[model samples]
Target chain A: MLVGYLGPLGTYSHAAALQQYPEEELKPYGTLEAVVEGVKNSEVELAVLPVENSTNGEVRAALDALIAEIGECPEIKAVGEVRVRIAHQLFSRSSNVSQVERIYSHPQVWGQASHWLSSTLPGAKCIDCDSTSQAIERAWEDKNGAAIAGSAAGSVYGIKPLIANVSDRDENTTRFLVLAKQPAPENKQHTMVTFCAAQQDLCKTLEALVSSGVQVTFLTSRPLGTHWTYRYIVEFAGALASEQVREALAKLNQVTPVTVIGAY
Target chain B: MLVGYLGPLGTYSHAAALQQYPEEELKPYGTLEAVVEGVKNSEVELAVLPVENSTNGEVRAALDALIAEIGECPEIKAVGEVRVRIAHQLFSRSSNVSQVERIYSHPQVWGQASHWLSSTLPGAKCIDCDSTSQAIERAWEDKNGAAIAGSAAGSVYGIKPLIANVSDRDENTTRFLVLAKQPAPENKQHTMVTFCAAQQDLCKTLEALVSSGVQVTFLTSRPLGTHWTYRYIVEFAGALASEQVREALAKLNQVTPVTVIGAY
Candidate 1:
C-alpha cells in the first residue's frame, strides 16, 4: 500500500498515516494541496489529511481544500477516519532546557504548548515556521533554538527532546480522514454530507433528518464567502446506501440543497 | 470610552473596534486573552474580538476564550456584532512592487493572498509574523520586504501600499463580536446559545427548536476534547427572553446539557 500525508516528516498526519497503513510506503507532501493532489493524480493510493483538532476545532485549510475540489476536480472522497493523540515534544540541539533562547513551531502548535512555553522558557522569543517539521529543522540548525512537535519528528530531525508531552491538554487529539477516488464501503454508523441552504430552510432540513430518525453526529456551518449564505457539513448516524438514510436525503434535497459526501 | 481589541494596530479586530465605536479610545491588546481579560477586569469598557471569517470560518482561539469563561470567571457577554470586508494591501518601504525581495504577513493572510503572491512575487521569500501589524512593522524596517495587512495598518506603520486588494477573494470578510462584562439588551432578532449534547439526543434537540418555529441562524459543534462527545454553539432567530425561545430551551434542557451564552 502507498499512502500520502502532510509533512516534511514526524507531523501528526505522519503518525496518522503510519497508524492506518503501517509497513506501507508513506510519502510526505509539503502542503495539503499536494497531499490531495497525490491521491487525485494516483501518485499515491490514498492521502491522509488532518480534518479537525479537539482543541482547535476544524482545520480550515484542509476543509477548504477538500471543499474546493467538490465541483471542479476529481471527486476525492473520505474513505476512512483515524484519530491520533497529540503529544508535543519540545526538541532542541542541546539536551539542556536552560540553553534554549528561542522557540519555533507552526502557530497552532505554539497555541497548544503556550502554557508550557510560558512557564518553562518565559523569555524565549517565539518564531512561527510553516510546519512542525520545519520548526524541528530550524531548531536542529540553531543551537539556541527549540521546537514543539511530535516526538517522532524530533528523532527524524536528529534532535533530542528538551521536554516531553508539553501540550496543555493530555487528551489533545486530531481527527484525520483518508481520501481516495472512491468512498468507503457503506458505513452504517455515519454518513457525511455537505449542503447549502437558505437561513429559513435550515430548520426544515434538520427536521427532515430528525424526522427520519437519523442521529446527527457532527454539524458545522461555513460561510460560502460571497453572500451572507453559509455551507453546512454534517455527519449523521446512518449509511448513504441504506433506505431510511436515502429517503431522508431525498426529502432534504426536495426542500433544500444537499450533497452526500461520504459514509464512514 | 476605552475599547480593547487584538492589535498592534490595523488587524481586523482593530478595524472592528473602530467600526463599532469610531470616537472611542482603542487599546490594542496583543493577545485575545488580554482583550477578554481587559473586559473582565473592567480595564476597558468593552472589547472587540474576531469570532469568524467568511473565507476561513471560526477563529477558534477567540471562541475557546469566550467558552472557557462560561463557568470559571466573570460572565462576559457578546454585546454587538461587526462584519468588516477584508482587503489586504501589499505595503513596503519602497513603492515599487518589483523591488520586494521578501514578503511578511500572518499565516492566514498569506493563505488568503497566496494566489496573488505566487504570480506577482514568485521569487520573494515569505515570512510569517505574529500579526498583520507586526508584519507591517517588519516591512517598514526592512527596505526589501513587503507585508500584507489592512491598508489602515500600513498607513499606521508609515508604510505605503505597493498594491491594494490583494486577497484572492474580493468578498472576503470577517465577523467580529463585541465583548463586555454585561450582556447586550435582549436582541429579539436572534439569540446565541452554547451547549453540549449527546449524539443520540441531537436529533431530538433540533426537532425541539424547529417544532417551536424558531429559526436557527447558525449551528456549529466542537469536540469536548476528552471524550467522543461534542459541544455546540447555536444562534437562532429568537430572543432567549422570549416565551417561545424559553419554552424551546426548557424542553431541550430536559433531555440534554445546554447553556444560554448570550441573548444577542
Candidate 2:
C-alpha cells in the first residue's frame, strides 16, 4: 500500500507515516491538502495527516483539509489514527550553541519551543521556514544559523543536534489520522464525528450523547464559513459498530446534521 | 486613557486599537503576551488584542495569552470587543505584481490569503516574518518581494498596493478584545467564561447553560498543557448583570469550576 504524508521529508508527519506503516510504500506530498487529495483521487491507498498536537492544540491546516474532504467527498474518510512523540532538536553545522545568531523552523516549532528558545537563545533571531526540513537546509547553508527538527531530519541533512527536545512541554505528541476512500473496518476502538448545529441545538446534542452514556474524548468547533456559526468535530470512545454509539449518533442526527468521519 | 496592542506600528491589532479607541494614546508591544501583560501590570488602561478572525478562526497566540492571564491573574479580564474589517493588500516597492518573486507576511496572513497567493502569484516563494509590518519592511528591502498587509500599513511604508483585499474570505473581520484590570460595566451585552472539566461534566455544564436559555455565541476547547485533557472557553450572549445569565452561571458553577473572564 502507498501512504501519503505532508513532507520533504523530516516533518513529524513523516515520522507518523513511518511509525504507522513501517513496511508500506510512503510518498511525501508538499502540503496537507495535497496529501488528503492523494487519498481522495485514489493516487495513494492511505494518507497520514496530523490532526492535533498535545502542545499546540489542533493542527488547523490538517483539520481544515479533513473537514473539507469529509464534508464534500463522501467516500473520503478517516480510517485510523497514529500518535507520534514529537522531539524537536536544534540542528546546526557549528559546534557551539552560543555562536548561533539566528534559528529557522516551521512556525509550529517556534510555538512549541518558545519558552526554551527565549531562555536559551535570548539574542537569536527566529526565522520561519516552510518546513522543518527546509529550515535544516537553510541552517546548513548559514554559518551562524540553527534549525529545529526531528533527529531523523538532522541525520538526513548531515547536521548535528545542538540541543534535543526543545519543546516547552515534555510530552509533546501529535495525533495523525489515516485517510482512505472507504471507512475502516468496524472493529476499531473509537468513532470520530463532525456535525453542524445551532448553539441551542448543539447543547442539546451534547446532552443527548452524554445521556446515552457515550464518552466523548475530544471536541473542537470551527467556523462554518460564516460569522458566529460553527461546526464541531468530535471524537468518542466507541466504535460505530457498537449499538450504544449508533443510538447516540442517531439521537445526534435528529438534533443536528452529523457526519461520521470514521471508526478507528 | 492609554491602550496597548501588538505592533511595530501597522498590524491588524494596531488597526483594532485605533478603531476601538481613536482618542487614546496607543502603545505597541512586540507580542500578544506583552499586550496582555500591559493590562495586568496597569501599564495600559486597556489593551486591544485580537481574539479571533472570521477567515482564519481563533488567533491562537492571542487566545493563549487570554487563557493564561485569566487563569492566573484574577484582576485581568476581557472587558469589551471591537470588530475590525480586514482587507489584506499586496504591497510592493515595485509597481508590477508579476515581478514579485517572493511574498512576505506573518504566518496567519499566509493562511488567510493562501488561496489568493497560490492563484495570483503561483511562482512566488512565501517568506514568514514576525509581523505584517515587518513583512512590509522586508518587502521594501527586497527588490523583487511583496508583502500582505493592510493598506494602512502600505501607506506607512510608502509602498503601494499592487493588489488589494487578498484575503480568502470577503467577510474577513477580526474580533479584538479590550483587556483591563477590571471587568467591563455589567450592563454590557455578553459574558465570557473559561473552565476546565472532565469530558462528561463538560456536556452536563453545557446542558445546564442551555436549560437556563443562555445563548452560546462562541465555544472553543484548548488542551490544558497535557495530553488529552482540555479547558473550554465560551462566550454567551447575556450580560452577567442579567438575571438569566446569573442563574445560568450559578448552575454552571455548581457543575464545574468556572472563571468568568469578563462581561462585555
Candidate 3:
C-alpha cells in the first residue's frame, strides 16, 4: 500500500505515517492539499495529516484542506488516529552552540522553541522553512546555521543535536488522523463531523449534540471563508450509525449544513 | 495615550489600532509578546492584537502571548474589539507582474493569496518574512521581487500595486481585541472568558452554558501547553456583571478552571 504524508522527510507526520503503516512505501507530499489530492486522485491509498498538537492548537492547513475538499471529494473520511509525543532538538553541524549564527525551522517549531532560543541564542536569526526536515537540510548545508527538528530528522540529514529535549513544555504531543476514500467500519468507536452553522445558531447546535448524550470529544471553529462568521468541526464519541448520533445530526442539520467526515 | 501593536507599520493590526484609537500615539512593537509586555509594563496604556481572521482561524502567536502573560499580569483584560477588512494587493517595484521572479509575504498572507499565486506566478519563489510591511520593505529593495500587503503598506513603502484585491476570498476580515491593565467597564455589552477543562468534561461545560441561556457568541480552543488537553476561549453575549452571566460562570467554574478575560 502507498501512504502519503507532508514531508521533506523525518517530519512528525512521517513518524505518524510510519507508526500507522510501518511496512508501506511512504510518499512525501510538500503540502497538506497535495496529500489530500493524492488520495482524491488515487495516487495514494491513504494519507496521514496532523490535526492538532498539545502545544499548538488545531492545524489550520489540514483543517482548511478538508473544508476546501468537502465538495470536491465527498468520499474522504478519517479512518483512524495516532498520537505522537513531540520533542524538538537543536541540531547543528557545528559542535558548539555559540558558533551558530542562524536557526532554520518551520514557524510553528519556532514557537515551541522561542523561550529556549531567546535565552540560548538571543542574537541568532530565525529563518522559516517549509518543513522541519527542509530546515534540517538547509541548516546542514550552511556553515553557521542550526535547526530545531526531531531526532529522526537529525539522523536522516546526518546532523547531530547540540542539545536535546529543547521544547519548553514536557508534555508536548501531536494528534494525527488517517484519511482515505472509504468510510470507517460500522463498529468504529468515534465519529468526526464537519458542519456549517451560523454564529447566531451556535448555541442551539451545541444544545442539540449535548442533549443527545453525544459526548463531544473535540470541537473547533474555522472561518467559513465567504463570510465573517464560522464553520465548526466536531468530533464526538459515538459513531454515526448510532441512533443517538443520527438524531443529533438530524437536529443539527435543521439549522445548518452538516457532513460526516468519518468514523474511527 | 499610547497604544501598542505589531509593528513596522501598515499591518492590519496597525489599521485596527488606528481605527480604534486614532488620537493615541501608536507604538510599534516587534512581536505580539513585546506588545503585550508593553501593556504589562505600562509602557503603553493599551495594546491591540489580532485574535482571529475570517479566512484564517485564530492567530496562534497572539493566543500564545496571552497564555504566557496570564499569570504575570492577572489584571489584563480585553477592553474592546476592531474588525478590519483584509485586501491583499500585489505590490511591486517592477511595472509588470511578469517581471516579478520572487514573492515576499508573511505566511498568513501567503495562505490568502495561494490560489492566485499558484496560477499567476507558478514559477516564482515565495519567501516568508517577519511581517507584511517587512516583506514590502525587502521587496522594495529587490529588483525582481514583489510583496503581498495592504494598500497602506504600498503607500508607506513607496511601491505601487501591480494588481489589487489579490486575496483568494472576497470577504477576508480580521478581528482584533484591545488589551489593557484596567478591566472593561461594567456596562460593556459582551464578555470574554478563558477556561481550562479536560477533554472529557467539554460536553458538560457546554451544556451548562447552553442550559443557562448564555448565548455563546464565539468559541475557540488552544493547547494547554503543559498537558495533552486544551484550554478554551469563549465569547458570549452578556456582560459578567449581569446576574445571568454570573450564575452561568459560577456553574461553569464548578466543572473547570475559569477566568474572565474581560467584558467589552
Positional deviation of residue B125's Cα in model 2 after best superposition, in angstroms: 2.2
State, as a TM-score between 0 and 1, how close model 2 is to the true structure.
Answer: 0.92
lDDT for each residue of candidate 2 in B1-264, tens digit (9 for 90 to 100): 999999988898888888888888999999998999888888999998888887777887788888788777888888888999989999888899889999999878877888888899999999878899999999889999989999768777776788877988888888988888985568889898888877656667766676787777778898876867788888888878998888888888898888888877
Please identify which of the two predictions, 1 or 2, would achieve the higher TM-score against the true structure: 2
Ranking by TM-score: 3, 2, 1
- CA lDDT of each candidate? 0.80, 0.84, 0.85
Clashing residue pairs in all predictions, respectively, total 0, 0, 0
Residue B24 error for model 2, in Å?
A: 2.2
* Residue pairs in clash, model 3: none
Residue B203 of model 2, lDDT score: 65
Interface Cα RMSD for candidate 1?
Answer: 2.0
lDDT of 1 by residue, B1-264 (tens): 899999888887888888889999999988887888888888998888888777766777788788787556647887677889899998888878999999999866776787899999999999978799899888878999988999768667665687978998898888888888885457546677787776666777888877777778778887775555678888878776777787778877877866666665
Error of 3 at A155 (Å): 3.4
Sort candidate 2 into its docking category.
medium
Model 1 bad stretches (over 4 Å) = A155-160, B155-160
Worst 10 residues of 2 chain B by lDDT: B199-208
